[model samples]
Target: MLRTILRREHKNRWERRAALVPESIAQLAAQKIPVAVEPCSIRAFPDEAYKAQGAELHNDLENFQLVLGIKEPPVASIAPQQVHLCFSHTIKGQPYNMGLLQKFIDQRATLIDYEPIVDERGVRTIAFGRFAGIAGAIDSFFVLGQKWLKMGKPTAYARIKQTKDYPSLSEIKSELAQLRVTNDKPLHVLIVGTGNVGKGAKEVCQWLGLPEVAIDEVLAQKAPKSSWFSVASARHLHERIGGGAFDYQEYLQLGKAQYRSIFDRLLGQFELLIQTPYWTDKYPAHLDIARMNENMQALPLVVGDISCDVNGSLKCTKKISTIDEPAYSYFVENDGIQDGIHADGISVMAIDNLPCELPVDASRHFSAILTRYVPELVKMDLNQTLTHSGLGKELQRAVIVYNGTVMPEFTYLQHYLDRHKLTKPSEAS
Candidate 1:
């Protein structure tokens, strides 16, 4: 039997989600797989719940060979030769997590990143993206209400509560269903992307009884009596630098090399912008500081950056907001960031871990999918080479580091490691 332990999340106080729920533990127990759980005071599922499912509550995870967590673990906690599964967040050569990656390499550990765990079609099999979108939209509305109130123009948004304040998703939907926006001034919302995140945001919009309109309708027509939303794809936001027809496939192959953002042209049309697209530095930003400064009067009153990629898609998202302090103002005139909604500048809500606000729901959804793969994950022998290992294609492709060495497919990260000068412990000595 493989020894596995569910580690407690320590990223922030708001991160109370569990990678494995009590039901998952019970399922593992039926298979005679004994599981351990670290005691966490604030976890959505308490220690007693895990204990009831025959899980041993232990502070030390040294005895456990396989450890599972939702987020990246701290560098000081990693042990030598352990098999760890988590969202490493270093695949993109993220400067912040390079030290954590270096620790894993030095310890000769096997790392399985959840971000790349995909099916044959390259679609992610397990993720909290949907919940992120759900909570993001909820919080975005709350921010808008507060922003409008601060600006001395209170609206129906003020009635919406923060996601954490709601007990369940049903309650949130009920509240939204009853909401009535009778303000004479029209409210227009624009959503970006069409993936799970976008769907989640759209679900919230539907609950609020907001009619979905086309981008052309949004740009050409006057704002309707009631609030309405429009969704935009990559083609709608970006165009060829020389003004040719937009070819999405070609744009994907050659990112910023040929594309320039046309999103600014539609800036004056919407009062709120909910961003949910997957973005990187290679893509043109939806709104840059220079463009924002130039079009301050046309800028949206609120920007809900659900995809919270720092300095990535929307350059105004200079930093990740916390659940405790979820809203901030971005002043384009001075390129300054001020906490909370101010009369000047746009109110920005960019919580990186939005799902954390609804821990119970997010954990339940995530654990259900993760439980299906736990058995196969624990059975794999980490001593063997990745090629020889019996892991299925999904798991195999998800391994970013095996036995302290960067996997061949992820060797590009070596360049970042070298640039950061993250030498091994022995090398440093």
Candidate 2:
């Protein structure tokens, strides 16, 4: 049997989530698969919990052949011929994680990224997206409350607290259920995307007893009795650049060449905008810098970017906020950011790891899905070609790197690696 270890997450103090939990460890133990866990003080599950499930507590994982983590591991940690499973965050050639990807190549290691582990339909089989949405929605309200209070205008949102402050998701929902918007000025919220993240955000809105209104209704309402929200999909946010109707398939295939964003025009209609969409440079940005500079006054009071892609869809998301400091004010005039809410400019909540705010819940949910794949992952032979490695289509498709070589499907990343090498100080000098 292959030796496996659940590595500790050290990316941030707030990253307390685990790829696997005690319950899954117990299942593996029942099958005679010995599991090792690195001692972590801040992990949602205590070391003793894993120990109870017959997991070995180890500090050094050098002996472990298979390593599992929730995020990208440190560059120094990659060992030759080892298999690593984690959210590598390098699928899109993310510049910040390019070094980490290169480390995997240099060490002759195999990298299986969880982000691309999808079914035949190309939908991700396992992800923290729903939890991200839930925490993001909660924090959005919290930010809105804080921003309003700073501006000397208190609303029902003022009573909401940050997602991390709550002990559990149930408690957060219960508290939100009690909040009542007594002010006559109805709050209109716009949620972008109708995926898992959007559904989770909508769940929070429903807890607040907010009705789902049409975008037309939101635009027509001069004064409303209660707070309401509307959801928008790609069709709602974009249009054909030329004189034609929006075609989703065409936009997906041609991206920016065929479509353009109209999201900026709708910003002023909502007090809050909770964005939860996937974006790449190929697509039109929801709010480009030029549009943002021109329409600063039309910006929403609070933008809860659950997608949290810095400078992705929403250009105002200049940087990713952390759990400790979950918000920043984007100054339109100077194109500067000031930590926390302020009276001037828009308050943006752009925490990249929103799921980490509810670590316990997020871990359990993730572990449940990931446990199904562990048995197969540990049993695979790294020496063989990926096609003959016995991994199912989902896992096979996720193998970005196989023994120092980038998979044929992901050869485009080589361009990014070459670009990084050219830009390196040593090469440039």
Candidate 3:
């Protein structure tokens, strides 16, 4: 029988999310599963809550077999032969996390990344994307209020607060409901994508009394009501350069080289953009830098980059800001960044961990999805051949490294890791 431990996250002091909520633990407790949660100082769920649910809280990990975390664990804290589960964020061969990956290799520990955990159809099984969208939307509104205040035109949104300041999503909505734009000009908000993240963002937009409109309605010359928002999915976002009907599979195969985003054409139509697309290197740039310069005077002033992929999809998303300093200015003229919001440039809210601002809500949302797979996750047996085990296969497929060796699916990362160690010898520890 595998003994699982829910470890505390120490990646950032502000990172208060937990891998499993107390409600999820209670379910495991009812089944008499061998699992324990270490007391954490900053976790959204208090130690008393887990204790109330019959979960043992402690700092020692000597007896635990598997450790679950929200983020990557510190290299020094990982026990040898321990099977770890978390969002390692190393699939991309990120330069900063190379040392952490190397530590796993040296320690003979297995790493099962949550980001890559997918079902048979390859849809991600666990995520905090929706909460991220909710937080991103709220923050974007706050940025708008700040910008308006700086311009000496205060609005009802000026009374709005940060996501963490609110106890729950309901309270956030209550505040949004009271918001009334001070000016006669309508706030034309464009939300990109329609996934879980987009849905959450849309919820916030709707609660703010923003009328949701279709893509065709957005292109109309007539302006929306004082508070209105529009949603655009993949069909409305891009077009085939060769002028044929867009095929999703063909687009994926051909990548960005074939598809061009039509998003820039309607740049001046909206005042704010709430981006929620899942971006990768293979995807086409959503907002072209050259086109943005050409339409600088007409472009949106505020951009809520919910995807938060630094220098990935959106050209203006030059850097990932923190919750403390969530908004930054992207100057189109100089192609440079200002630390905070500036009247001369467009303000971008691109905090990478937007979900962290609403830690409790995000944890609960994440736990709902993760709890369904806990029974199968805890049944994973390292000693047995993964091929013969039914429950273990789910976890086995997500395992990037097993017993210090790179798994078959992740073999390509070997060269990247080798190069990382050579360039930065200090990370070899």
TM-score of each: 0.94, 0.95, 0.94
What's the lDDT for all of these models? 0.87, 0.87, 0.82
Residues 283-320, candidate 3: write the lDDT tens digits: 78777687777788887889999998887777889988
How much does candidate 2 score in TM-score? 0.95
lDDT by residue for model 1 (1-429), tens:
458899999998989999999998998889877779999999989999999988999888777788999999878888888888999899889877888888889999888999999998889999998898889998998898888888898778889999999988989999998886534346788989888899899899888888888886655655464668888888887889888899999999889999988887788888888999888888888788888888889999898999888887788888988899998998888888999878778889999989998899899899989888888888887767887776888999999888899888999998999867755454558
In model 2, what lDDT does residue 133 have? Answer: 89
Task: Point out where model 3 deviates above 4 Å.
Answer: 180-185, 220-226, 389-393, 426-429
Give the winner by lDDT: 2 or 3.
2
What is the lDDT for 233 in model 3? 81
Candidate 2 structure quality by residue, lDDT tens digits, 225-263: 467889888887788987688888898999989888877
Candidate 2 overall lDDT versus native: 0.87
- Candidate 2 Cα outliers beyond 4 Å, as residue runs: 182-185, 216-225, 425-429
